[model samples]
Every structure is written in structure tokens, then in C-alpha cells.
Target: MTDHEDDLGPRVASFRELRGMSLRALAAAAGVSTSFLSQLENGRTNASVASLRKIAGALGVSPAELLDERAAHTRGVLRADRRPRLEGALGVEKFVLSLPPLRNLEVYAGEFAPGASTGANPYTHGNAQEMFVVIEGTVVFELGGERFEMSRDDSIEFLSSVPHRIVNESEAEARVIWINSPPTPDEAHGA
Candidate 1:
């Protein structure tokens, strides 16, 4: 793990603010306490691998990015498989498929087990937009008063500012590639 990964709170917090998520909101989304997140961000404590993965997921980064600022500063071609996975709750799984720092946008590929999701209630960001495709198994998407049953190769794109939910009903694992960009408040803005 890199220094940031070793001391993940501050970097993770920075990305939270970047995404316009409150400590309470992020803590809720990551399945951790706000106080714990505060401590981590303040550099008063070290995060577990699970915790780091959750924070990285919420921040739309790979677990490795928090540790390796070098990648954040490195400018060149990067391999998709080499990118890091963002951490989430104990049962949830998410990762940035491939993203370079300072780019104004972020993309991710996430896997949710049979009963996991982003969180209990939906979350919103500034002008945020997300698109996801079910690469395998089935994904249940609740967006804008619609319940979409997405199977393999099914996809949906919408304003993330709207409340949403995701679920995997298949006996097999559910895999989705999601892209989130420009934060929240930008939802009403032009594409």
C-alpha cells in the first residue's frame, strides 16, 4: 500500500468533498461511522483493507490510487486490469475500471453480491450522471420511478441526482461496469 493507502482517511475525504458528499452521507454509503471516517481522514487512524476499499469505491477510485499518488501524477497509457478496486461495505465490491487523476471524470466497474447495494437510501451528487451495464447475471435497477430488470449486456444511463437502487437477483454473481462523472450538482447542466 502507498502512503495515502497507509493513511487513507485524508485522501478519501478529499475525494468525498470532490464528489460533494457529506461525512454522514459517505459514512452511510461506505457502511462506516462518520466519526470513524473523520478519524481516518484526519490521519489519526489506519484503515483496514475492507474500509479502504469502501472509501476508494465511494471516491470513485481504485484502492491503489489512494496509496500511489505516483499514478495520480503519472501521465501516460494505463492498463485496465492494473487499475485498483475501491472498497465498500463488508459484503459489497466496487472498483475503478480505468481512470487517470486530474481528468474531470471517473469510471468504475463494480460487482455486487446477491444482497448488496450502494446503500440503504439513494444518494445524489452535483450534476452527477452514471451509466451501468450488466456484464453477467442480472441487475435490478430502480431509477426515476422505474424498475428496470437488466440482464447480461443490459444497460442504463441516467442522472445520478435521482434516487436509485441496484440489486442482483440471480444465483450467480452480478457484475456491472459503471461510469460516474463531474460530480453531482451538474445534473441539470448540458451534456
Candidate 2:
């Protein structure tokens, strides 16, 4: 397993404890066996993508939240090398640019390799507003059933509840910024 996978156990334990959830409680909610969760928390086992998703959903957070750790030494600022990040679906690397004390906002900087995508299917979350801005290269933003091809400096906004996904169909890498107001499963779920 990679360092990120190794850290998942501790992050899960921390989040579960913070939420005042017991091992059995979380396992039941996530529909996984207690022994599995225990082993996962103890680093005796690794979690599959499906299991991770279930656990994250049960905890009212995105899988990425459970995988990332704040490594910056300075307060209110995220060092480039220390930024919390998510190795997103299909070669998409998402870095959370907003530091701790998250408040009601969240910002993500993403690098999408050629053919990279948010996921195979669109997804919706939170009840706030969301915006996607392309910094370089080209990307396709699929919102609901519509597809909008965006290039450098182009942007689009919509409710966070709308099913959406970003895709880089170009041969070059695409850099983009995503902004969410009132955050998402984090502050939105009172985390």
C-alpha cells in the first residue's frame, strides 16, 4: 500500500472518534463487518474503493476527506508540497487549497491528465453553489445531461446538487479550480 493508504486507518479512527461513533455503530451504518472496520482502523487491512465509499458516506464525508491529511507547518497557508490531496478517479489529482479552519468555503486545485475524469458517472453533493474554472488546456463539464466544453480561463457555475463531472479529453493536461460555497459534506454535515 502507498503512504496515503497507510494513513487512511488513522484518519478513519480520528473522524469516527470525533463523530462519537463506535466501531460497531460505524460498521453497521456502513454495512461492513466490525472485524473489517477494526482491522482497517488498526492498519491490519486495506479498504477497497467500494468499502471506502460506504464508510465515507456513513460518516457524511467524501472518500477524499478520509484519505487526506493536513501536512502544512504554517497556519492559514498550505505549502505546495504539504497540501492535502486526493488521488481522484482516472488520473485526476485534486489538491485542497483551503487550509484548516475551513469555514463555509472550499477550494480545490486539480490537474487532470489526458483522458482523466472525475469519474465514470456524474455525482451530486452539498446544497451550496459550485463553480468550475479551467486554468489551462481543455475540459468538458457535464452538468445534468448537458456537456459544456471549456478552455483556458473559461468557467461555469451551478448548484452543488446538480449531477456533474469534469473530463479532460485533450491530449495535454488540464489545470482547473473548483470552488464550493458553504463547503460540502464537511461543514455542510456539521463536521
Candidate 3:
């Protein structure tokens, strides 16, 4: 077996442990057989992304976490004005937004270029109240049935439980820092 197979096993085991879930119980939740889960945990089988996703969802985790400790850890934080950018879905770019990584919360800075939007789909996250502090320009915040406009230095805090989206209609880029305490909303669920 390749190293990838070995790396995947512990994550499976970790998930089971974190939820205090039995193998049979987790299998039932994931729609997989107990024997299959056992093999996957022991690195005897290759678990597909779909299986991993189901496992993650049932455990209230993001699929990206399946990478776990296998990825290298960065040595230090990226400085202000030097924050690395991660582009998310819907053509949005999320900058570090100038916040350090601490235990209880995660802070992100994002910039939406002119005409960029979070799209029209409405979705709910586990538990998060995203506080947006507009630092650069104006943004139209759409939360559930309400819409609000925020300007420079203006802020809006709301529960992330409902569907929301942001639109930057101006010709200039919209910069904002999003702060979330207890980073993972469904953190009460798993590893």
C-alpha cells in the first residue's frame, strides 16, 4: 500500500474517537458496513472521497480536514500586508485579513473585486456568526431576508446560521475582515 493509505487510517480512527462513536454506529451513520470501516481504519482498504465525505459530514467536519496532519505546518504567521491569499469557490479571494491564529477563533480578511459576489445560493453552516468590518469599501450584505449596506470602518455582526451573500457593486474592491469565534461552528460534534 502507498503512504496515502496509511495516512488515511488514523483520521478515520480519530473521527470515531472524537465522536465517542462505535465502529458499527459510525458505519450505520455513514451508510458503510462495519467491516468496511474496520478495514479502512486499519489501512487495509482505500477509502473513497465520497465515503470520507459522508464520514466527515456525520462527524460534523469539513472534508478538507481529511488531509489532517499529513500536510506540512507553516513555521509562522504571514505578516500584515503580506498575508497569503486563498481563493474560495465563486471567484472570491480570502486574505488573512490581518489576524493571528489563536485557539478559540479564526479571523479572515477577504477582498471582493468589483462585480464579484458570493452567488445566489443560500446555505447554512453549523454555528458561526460572521462579523464583517468593512475597512476599504462598500458591500451589500444579504442575510436571510434582510439586506444591509456597509461602508468603510462600518461593521455588521450576524449569526451564520442562515443563508447569506455579499456583493460589491462599486468599481473599487471591497475589503473586509471576518472574525469567527470558536472557529468551527459545529465544533461540539467532532475532531
Candidate 4:
């Protein structure tokens, strides 16, 4: 295998393992044959775009994430301008503060314009833990049917499995820092 392919195989295998999926399980989820997946993971074959998409979908990540060269590097200090921004809801902007190999943790800085929110519906992740800290302005978080209002310097942490949504009702823009442990794969795609 070429160097790139060699690097890709281990990454695919590592992500699969991190999700606690066996080869057969991942193959089934990705709608590919177990043998084919084994070959791909062993660097014996390359994946087509369709296959990569399927694999990424099954892993709850974007194909771009699987293909990112930077994902292979571990940068100790990420510059402000170098941080990757995430696609968020209207009036909300999110920037990733953490670097590659996002297995254990993720940190993000978010700015929410007035009246912005994480939508009306609440969302949930698997078993990850999350913390949100308000840097400026005020925001409210609704978690598991309870509402909590937070202001500058205030923080909250909880299991991400609980249904939650964030809201900025103030007239001013709100800024926050979000930290997650055992980062959710969907977050990798800015979901």
C-alpha cells in the first residue's frame, strides 16, 4: 500500500475500534461485505467515494473527516486562525478549538446572535459528557425538561445523553465554550 493508504487503513480501523464495533459489525452497518472491510482495514484495498460515504455514515462522521490529512497529526497548540469552524444553526457560529485524533475530548467556541438557539427540538448523544461555559452575555439550556439560565463565567456539565437545547434570549450576542469528553462522532461533522 502507498503511504496515504497505509495511513488511512489504521485510521479506519481505529475509529471502528473506538466505537466498539467488530469488523463484521462495521461491515454490516456500512453495507459492505466483511471480507471487503477487512481488506480495506488491512490496507489491501482502497475505498471508493460511495464506500467511504457509507462507512462515514455508519460511523456517524463525514467522509471529509475520514479523509482529513490533519486528522492524522497531533498538534499540541492550535492557532486561533487554524481552528476549523463547524456548521451550526442560523445565527450561531462554532469553531473547533481542539486538534486531531478526537478520541477522548473536544473543545469548541461558539457565538450566538440574539434570538439564536439550537432549534426548538432537543437532541441527544450516546454516552458522552458535556460542559458548557458562558464567556459573555447570557444563555439558557433546557436539559431533560428542566431549564437553567446561565450568565457570563457560569458553567454546567451533564451527560450528553439527556435531551438538551441551548437558547440565547437576550438581545445581545452570547459567547460560550463547549467541552465534551469521549467526543461524539457526529460532532466531527459539525452536526
| Best-performing candidate as measured by lDDT | 2
Point out where model 4 deviates above 4 Å. 1-74, 187-191
Off by over 4 Å in 2: 1-77, 187-191
User: For candidate 2, lDDT tens digit of each residue in 1-191?
Assistant: 99988989888887776555689988998999999999999999999999999998887677888877762112234588988886578688889886534445778899999998988888888878988899999999999999999999999989988888888999999999988886788533210
TM-score between model 1 and native: 0.52
Q: Compose the digit string of candidate 3's lDDT tens values, residues 33-110.
A: 899889988888887889888876665565666556542222234676687676554646786542322334557777
* Angstrom error at residue 44, model 4: 30
C-alpha lDDT (0 to 100) for residue 30 of candidate 2: 94
| lDDT for each residue of candidate 4 in 45-124, tens digit (9 for 90 to 100) | 99998999998788766777677656533333678788898888999999998655345787899999999987778888
lDDT for 132 in candidate 4 is 89
Estimated TM-score for each candidate: 0.52, 0.58, 0.51, 0.59
lDDT of 4: 0.81
Per-candidate Cα RMSD to the true structure, in Å, reads: 12.8, 12.9, 10.7, 7.5
Error of 3 at 15 (Å): 26
Q: How good is model 4 by TM-score?
A: 0.59
The global C-alpha lDDT for each of the candidates, from Candidate 1 onward, is: 0.69, 0.82, 0.69, 0.81
Q: Number of clashing pairs, model 1? A: 17
Query: In model 1, what is the error at residue 125, expressed in angstroms?
Result: 2.4
Pick the winner on lDDT between candidates 3 and 4.
4
What clash pairs does model 4 have? none
What is the per-residue lDDT of model 1 for residues 86-168, given as tens digits with 9 covering 90 to 100? 66654567776545333456666777788776666555555566777888888788886678999989888887778777766
